[model samples]
Target: MARLNFVLLIAVVFSALYLVRTQYESRRLYVELEKASAQSRKLTTEKERLQVEKRAEATPLKIEKLARDRLQMRTTTPAITQYVEYKTAPAVQKASHE
Candidate 1:
């Protein structure tokens, strides 16, 4: 009867230890999930800000300003424009003697 009681005590201690370990793992996972959610919110806000900037830049007036100022491009009068093309000479045939 004493040996049976000792076995029961050991089983109860091991069961308690298992329960503690399981709870610890669950708490750790919960903390990690909270951190990931916070990071996701931060990235979502940044994406929205970038989208607003993109929309502002896509305006036609902004594009024209960038093209004229940065690229130095201007609308040319038809009389100021000229087209030229170069023609290549034909290749000469080589004679081979056997």
Candidate 2:
């Protein structure tokens, strides 16, 4: 009977230790999950902000302004327009001396 009591005490102690370890691991994982979710939310907000700015920059007025200011381009009038065709040259072979 004394031996049985000793064995039961050992079993109970091991069970308690296992439970404590499992609970600690669960808490740690929960905290990590919360942090990852917060980061996802922050990145999603930043993506939305960048999308809004992209739309504004793609407007026709903005395109015209960029072309005129950066490229120094102007719309051509009908009187000054000319069209050119691409010309191809024939290949010539060089004479080699033996």
Candidate 3:
């Protein structure tokens, strides 16, 4: 009878320890999940902000101004246009061998 009681006590202790370990692991995972959610929210806000800035920077007037200022480009005009002619070389005739 005493040996049976001892075995039962050991089982109970092991079960209690396992429950505590499981609870600790659950809490740790919950904390990590919360952190990841917060990070996701932060990344979403940043993406929205960058999108707004992109829209502002890509306005047609802004693009035209940047093209004119950064690159020396101008609209085509008849005054600056020139015409060129193409000439082909005459073909050479080979002498017949006797």
Candidate 4:
């Protein structure tokens, strides 16, 4: 009878230990999940902030200013504009007339 009681006691202790280990693992996983969610929220807000700044930086005036300053480019004016005349091949011109 004492041997049977000893076996039963060991089984109970093992079961208790397994339950504690399972609960500890569950708590750890919950903590990790919460931390990951917080990180996701932080990254989402940062992405939104960067998107807003990108929109602000991509305006037409900003692009023109950067082009003028960095590339030393100028907008074309009528005074500097040139006209081009195209001379077609005689065979192609004749085909078009026909």
lDDT of 1 by residue, 42-80 (tens): 999999999999999999999999999999988789898
- Rank candidates, lDDT, best first: 2, 4, 1, 3
TM-score of each: 0.73, 0.75, 0.75, 0.83
Q: Cα lDDT of all candidates, in order?
A: 0.97, 0.98, 0.95, 0.97
Q: Which stretches of candidate 2 lie over 4 Å from their true place?
A: 84-98
User: In candidate 3, which residue ranges exceed 4 Å CA deviation?
Assistant: 81-98
Clashing pairs in 1: none
Task: Please write out the lDDT profile of model 2 over residues 3-86, one tens digit for every residue.
Answer: 999999999999999999999999999999999999999999999999999999999999999999999989899888998999
Alpha-carbon RMSD to native, per candidate: 3.6, 4.8, 4.2, 3.8
Judging by lDDT, tell me the better candidate of 3 and 4.
Answer: 4
The residue-by-residue lDDT of candidate 4 on 1-98, one tens digit each, is 99999999999999999999999999999999999999999999999999999999999999999999999999999999999999876764445564
- Stretches > 4 Å off in candidate 4: 85-87, 92-98
lDDT of 3 by residue, 15-93 (tens): 9999999999999999999999999999999999999999999999999888889997777799999989998888888
Clashing pairs in 2: none
**Candidate 1 global lDDT:** 0.97
